[model samples]
Target: MSNIQKIGNPARQSNNLLFKRRSILKTLSLAALLPVGLGAYPSGIVIAADGVPLPENVMTPDAALKRLLDGNKRYVSGKISVRDFNVNRAILAKGQNPYACILSCADSRVAPELCFDESRGDLFVTRLAGNYASLDILASLEYGTAVLKAPLIMVLGHTDCGAIKAGMKADKENVDFPGHIQTITSELKSAVKEGVKLPGNATDNVAKENVRLNVAKLKESTPILRQLVADKKLMVVGGLYHLDTGKVELLT
Candidate 1:
């Protein structure tokens, strides 16, 4: 990579990046979304940021959830559909209209796009280890749901989360990292505390419980989100991503 390449035409640069990203994404087994030969989505389908079109049914929370669950079923069965990113790139370049929002972990292996078998632009996502409903995270969600009008929001946790493991160890050992790591550890530990009463492995139980905790927090969020929930315009739910099975087990 040269400095000339770094300052190249912005549009060309963006396209180059998108092309490279698609190349990488296509290689993943779970990145499979819709097969290219399916023709087009129904007349009710609309374009999203990722360039994939979402059916009108996905405009509603229940319908959106169903879409994701079905995709996961396809993923778990290893029956993935092929997608042509070259076409979708043109569609997505115009704009994005994602159907759902997900708060998930930062774990490298836990790619939500693959886990749910969603193409790009189909899901608006925010991630961090031990996915908590922090103030900044809520602000982003407010924009995604209120402005972007995504009907469903899912708080996703996963198995063998390093954040969860670290938080658990911190609780048992009272270890402290040098910087902001302690802060994130603290948030995860709180969820661990809540899940301690449940019977099971500490990290695994906390991972699921953390999702439940965030779901409740987001539902009660005021002004924008709460009102949307009240009007049935938005829904907040939770799930656990099983690493071994490549499945998202809905917690709520």
Candidate 2:
């Protein structure tokens, strides 16, 4: 039942994994069958095990937001149970067709899967100190969108982000970086500038603005994403994760 075992043994499908997958598919089918307010229990339908069904398609910005919000709600409420490591490992042995590409900070507190309540093979994540867009990151994102055909891309930032804080305090006389840390600080300077204009805590403001700025930059700087957006083939979104509340608010 270990994660590695579950993944390595393809022929074995745990009862939990099978049940969950079936429930997810059923929920999606039911949602499609039931119109907005016409079904018997149509006020709103909750999936089995309290897990929300991902949207049938995530090609549009609105659909992407809905999917992430559902996942975050499950995460915030402590309802995530899909981490059957063995099963996931096996599933991923074939390949990963993650539904979304996430660009997030290297902050220890901001593990993307935990925040979004996703399991292995569910997300394609690229982590850097400031969630800054670099050439390599952009190339990876292109692979996710164009090759993997992931429907969504998200720039995730969190409150109390250390990278942003470092950038904001970069003016210190003795500031020093041994390796690529200086590059991270430099990339975060624009976020720091944007954060200063907001009215609340500097760190929180910077984190939120950083997410927005990164998303904007991804859309503007990458021809692949730009073409995707223009053709309505993909969606790009920004979100801020609150550590205290375990809530993720979509910025756009």
- The model with the greatest lDDT is 1
Error of 2 at 66 (Å): 1.7
Question: Model 1, range 1-252, lDDT digits (tens) per residue?
Answer: 643366565322322432344433532322233333323333444445343354443468898899889988999999876877776676665455688899999899888788778787788999987888775676688767765678999999998889988888788899997777887787777688887779877778988888888898788744567778999989899999899999899899
State the TM-score for model 1: 0.77
Model 2 per-residue lDDT tens digits across residues 1-252: 544354443222222332344444643564355433211223333232322233233345566567778989998998876666776464345444567889988888888888878777678899988787775787688777765567789888888888887887783443766676777777777788888888979888988888888788777665556777787778888888888988988886
What lDDT is reached at residue 203 by model 2?
89
Off by over 4 Å in 2: 1-61, 88-91, 172-176
The alpha-carbon lDDT assigned to residue 70 of candidate 1 equals 91
Candidate 1 clashing pairs? 48-97, 49-96, 50-120, 50-121
Best by TM-score: 1
> Which sections of candidate 1 miss by over 4 Å?
1-58
